[model samples]
Target: MADQIRPKWALVAHGGAGAISRGQLSPEQEVAYRDAMAVAADAGAAVLRAGGSAMDAVEAAIHLLEDDPLFNAGRGAAFTAEGRNELDASIMDGATLGAGAVAGVTTTRHPISAARAVIEGSTHVMLGGEGADAFARSQGLEQVDPSYFFTERRWLALEKGLARLGLPIPARPTGAPQDLSGKAALVHEEGKYGTVGVVALDAHGDVAAGTSTGGSSAKRWGRVGDSPIIGAGTYASNKGCAVSCTGAGEYFIRLGVAHEICALVRHKGLSLQAAADQVIQGELTALGGDGGVICVAPDGQMAWSFNTPGMYRARIADGEPLVVGVYKDET
Candidate 1:
């Protein structure tokens, strides 16, 4: 009954937040990234154009990013220290405070769908680890062979990152606590890359938010970061806005970035843009964390903010469904 608002409707996405610079990527890579982003943006916009729910548009857009190996979500997820792939994802519906999440799930074909199931299934606001995986099975979510997640590119990238950490190559010692100083530096060095995020305003004016990731490269077991957490990595609330973020997980967890943005809007009387900008440029930076986010307010306004050299981002509006991806300065 509340789904009849005719907001302008918008969609935004990010591939991943990291330190990608013009100097690092060839023109060819830039073109390919934009091409893929356009494809994803169009898919999302199409759903919105057809009077689909904001949830549908958000999921459609994110699903495109998930399937693309160019980004680090589902198919192209990074590897765990054990050389296995575990994916995490979450979704939120702004109108209801309903949310769902999955962690350490290796077999679900659509991690995001599992998250949505959790959002609608019960009164529980979150689920994790084996519990989340089991919920997926009970819901009849598609399952994939574990090997379907393997990616040589991601593996080799993590291996190189480990090498730069001054750790032994190829061995990644068993049961040894990693020396994180060097690894942290490497992570910071590549900290500008953003995560795959989606925010949508459907024809009915409802707002939805979603985020998915492979987590940090070579992350430890049970070391779940913010990606699958509602208030940290993503949040949606009809009272103000819907947000999805990508950045240093440690700082995001510390700051509660997503929920904090919504709170500033609901409590301080700040606009969605003002709250988001403040958090990204003020609080997050002060905490020594860097990254960016893609968001949409309930009014259908949109924004992207980052403190790093570049963020892989794209946007589509009601008028045009073009996908535009950028890695460096925006003119």
Candidate 2:
């Protein structure tokens, strides 16, 4: 009976997850976040409504989110221990199991697009550092100076994170904001971890997933998180579902969070929601990790789960209104 009403197309997205809760933001901040998410979700859902491929829809959605400074992806990404913006992203096509990723990209304007470029143009599954940036440039994708990703908010966050770790802060990037006054209180540890991702089920019954991030604040030694790693931060399969995860990268990588959810749905016949809950609520929690995920299936099923106080998420399906969420209780 539930399947009888399933929509032909659906999409879901997340703007990272962690220790978020009610009152975490002021009225203005909440509105900004909600509006940003809606715009991104609508951009993706519009493609599916037009009979576009799931991969196209996923890419379209992430492109918008990556551009917006409200979420941590492209322009507003966090800083590393060296105070540089090192971005990572990945995308997967469920129907073909074709995937592409880029890690530690410092100059690509849109890492998600760089990832898509990899899948469509290259034989390699992943590219990193200067090579990844070079590939994006060769593809004619927009390239920015390293400091284009700088945000006063993120800079403040980096300073606070480093202070807590007793690490000496590096000098600011070349073209950074000159003033840093009165912004220290705004940077909280809980807000330092963030990523943006999307999953879509298109009219052709195909699914796809994509994720992008600036990685953990104040991270050192070229650490790459789960966002750029297939089957960890992102996984999709038309056989069951598509999953994009956000949280502590180490745990997500160990649990193979994204792939495990799809595996449970495909192999154990668990429902999309059940599989998501099992992986995020049960297995991930048992490991003492905190985070969340957004998922969508070709059958139009959609679900999200997070162990933290909140997760920034949204979803849309054919013949249904868009739904946006933040706090855990909003579930």
Candidate 3:
């Protein structure tokens, strides 16, 4: 009976958020970002329109984004202080409240899939470091050499980050790309806050959310951001809405932005837009954090809010056309 129920559906996605502005991206660069987002969102929307579960739709969307170099997730993830790539991702099912996550993953080809494996195949809600990669390997997920994630654009960004922070720049990765002469100007404030996320409402009236990131460039130690932490960067609930956030990971973590948004909607009788606005505009801003979120509810509400100059975002409802935005003005 429950499986036969069909309901309104929608999907929303974000390709990170930060001080992105109108003149910041070249016309070609802007088109590339928008096209990539549309393709990813379309992939997920196709799944939902085909009667896939919210969980599957969310995974389908993020999986495509993780593969794109334009957005930081898998292939173009940021470099750590050691110049190595460490990925993080998380996903949640609104129908069951079952969530999974992975942090500091080194070799998994798709961190989003690895996170889903945690929810469906393992007892744990989260896994980290070598163990997380090992578990992903055991599940037969694709594995890549560390160098596979390295891009010259990100390598230079690492140096700039170290310089800006007044820290020593580390040596390049062992098998790094050789052509680092150019592409530096192409890398700017946007890459520093790069992450990808998706929120979907499937035909079953279930909502699911997922988020993936490469963390901050030149992040020291084993710093894990809010991306892989349940209730922090990702949250979904059948009772209200699903949310995926990209921002200053530290503040988002402290504020529990994802879960907080859903809580406001489900508990405080706030509308989805109001709840999101209050969090991103009021609470997060008050705390001196700037970023954005994409949300979808089972009732067909799709909303996004960011305090920065712009956020790369897209959303699509059942029969509607896909809409995308890069700057703050594109409502």
Candidate 4:
């Protein structure tokens, strides 16, 4: 008789955290994003079903989001106030506590690949700015034109943010200052948008976490935030669970959101849902911070918690996995 075989696993992903609202996105755009999310979730589920590591599944899922221009990460990243494109990303394995990250890199085609390189190649846990770029080149990772990140939508968004906030329009030394107040005012006049991330558990019950982002629109130089930091933007532990977050990056760093959620499960005996809720509503909100997180436990349970108005998230589990693209509170 053939050997019996079965596998159980789960995956969760988030596009970002911010003032996302359904009113701002058209019905056509919503469906397109949901379709993309489904493809990403399936890619990850296939790896998990084949007995791949949670880390592998999470990374696979994120690759799709990274390539999607609809989200502000990887290929579609937003420009900084100075009209530059710098990206940051990180990945963590709960089983080994092995973590890697890259920040302030402009040439690496995929920032996450550089992060993985860091974990596999170095004794250190983090690398940032130009040093991170040099490391990516040394590792022989693929490179892309910095302009590969340019998107008309993101460019307009940057301008809108600066003008509304009364900041100067960054000008090129060789060119006259471009008029952008109109563009800035148009994209963010309503204060609506967010980021992307993923958390996963494999058949072996191992946990993994990954987060990728283009950084804040028009951010100042060298302003590295939480995305490239393990505990702040992402965390995972096979002993409990895995988590990926998006929101106010500074507050997430201060609260150590991802690690705290895992800790709640390990130390306070909280369920995945309970832990995430406590962190988003009880801790983050209490601290006067706003954001959200997507998480998964070894048992295959998943949760998306947010104190903000909405979180662009998706989950795959059981016989019927589903993607959630709405911007309002699901609760």
Candidate 5:
């Protein structure tokens, strides 16, 4: 009898995508970001090594990023125009085509956990704002005061955004929405591109993807980004691939970048690498936007592509050691 090939598992993750120029980040800061990516990848790889589902692995990896203040997901989230935190997250199970998402939730400490709860515990695919926070509380997930999400670094970012717009700083930071109609909100920073995501293929050949973010800095009127939108920021399928995106949220949502990559792979018969490159480089670039994606195929093949100066990413495939990178040159 011929020897049967064993199924392989793979994992990939990204912090964000933007102009992470070499001259911008100090050696110490670069080491810190690379170490954080390694830790997140290790968390997911450990689950896959133990025969856990891809869903579990993705969630585990994202949870670590959310907890760490280094990435801009949970604890390190950016502030809105109102100088408050509003989080968004989404998760998908490729084997079952099940997805859950939460948007604009201010009190949920880990929005990704709440998103998973919606997938496994409820029939709804998405929940938003106070309703999402209510559902998260009912699920017994941890809840924190809105102030728990406050970080001085992010506060300064918001102030910088207002300054860029030539808007006067608010006398007191309140939750009231600001009128930002003609003002261009900054999505990318020199060092912090602003979201975190993961994609994983498990021992059973199932794939999963998830994304979490604080939306754009200095955003107003409850702006919700592509991170909580399934086809835009996160997608997974056993027959195609799993993808998670980070970049300009509006362009991502309008372009359906995540699903478009999978469609090109499924219908056009393009390899995972080709599909990802086309979308990140061709489609998104033409739309006058910048971002990045991390994708994993069913057979444990993986690709990470970005149209920016750099992206924080890590990957591990079948019997391979974990690889981490922060700049385009490293890849």
Candidate 6:
């Protein structure tokens, strides 16, 4: 009977999480970030308002972000140490527990759409590298040259990373270092850490989540982060909620941040807000990982939490004005 009843819809999204201090951004830049959040939120909420599935809503929202160069997921993805871009994405449908993902992919115009194709067309849960690109082509997804991913801003970040390591700019893109311990920390601290994600609750009460990223700046050896890992960065369940995370991939994977929130709700009887806070504020902070997540519950409740100084995020529920913020203080 509960499943038969239509619920009010809600949608939420995040650009990324990190030390986004007030003085770091100009007034115009702040407005740009907030405006981007509102656009992303409106895109997804529009689908929900039209009685679309949560899966569709989440995908629609992420598409808008991926197209925007302001975020670090698709067009503006960070460059590897070798100055190349390798994109990753994942999507999940909570109603059926079906999911799809792609990693180390290049040339696929929209990695999220490829992920959706994998869910709808294949028996596999994920594909990577050349194989994923081939599949995307077969599905008729838009394809682009790898050069299309290049952005001057991300290239500068790579240069900064090399500088932090006391390494000279190589004559050629020799790829990143084998071990990027200190280097990765420098990239994150400089606010180059980013990802894009969305979660939605549809009129039918189903929840879905999706995430996309370009991996870490100056990363090497086909490194994959939490963005494309289903439970680590994205999860959804009709019985609980949908979660999309953006943070240090290793910590999120080890802590199972995304699924942990859903598990807390299903097994521990915690509300969506409490569950998200426990993971983002408690476990993640204790582990020294700075990031955040957007969550939407089956009951149309929404929650977002981050341990960092700021997270680019927005939320909208039925009949409510969009609420967008980039700093912790605003929320």
lDDT of each residue in 242-281, candidate 1, tens digit only = 8899988778888999999988877897876788889999
C-alpha TM-score for every candidate: 0.88, 0.96, 0.95, 0.89, 0.92, 0.92
Return the top candidate by TM-score: 2
- Residue-level lDDT tens digits of model 4 in 1-331: 1112222778898887777676876676667666777888888888888889888888888888887777778866777778787899999998899999888888788788788889998787788878988898898988877766666667777888889879887653232234434222223211333456888887776889999888888787567768888899989998878989887788889999999999999888798899999999998999887888999987777888887766667888646547665476553
- Residue 267, model 5: Cα distance from true site in angstroms: 1.2
Residue 15 error, candidate 2, Å:
0.4
Off by over 4 Å in 5: 1-7, 168-193
Check candidate 4 and list the clashing pairs: 15-195, 15-196, 16-195, 17-195, 80-218, 81-218, 159-184, 160-184, 160-185
For candidate 5, give the lDDT: 0.86
Instruction: Name the 10 consecutive residues with the lowest summed lDDT in model 1.
Output: 180-189
TM-score: model 4 vs. ground truth: 0.89
The lowest-lDDT stretch of 10 consecutive residues in candidate 3 is 180-189
Candidate 5 collision pairs: none
lDDT of 6 by residue, 169-225 (tens): 534333323333321222223265689999998888789999999889888778899
Worst lDDT run of 10 residues, candidate 6, spans: 181-190
Which pairs clash in the backbone of model 6?
none
Better of 1 and 5 by lDDT: 5
- Model 6 residue 185 CA deviation (Å) reads 24
C-alpha lDDT values of all predictions: 0.76, 0.89, 0.89, 0.78, 0.86, 0.85
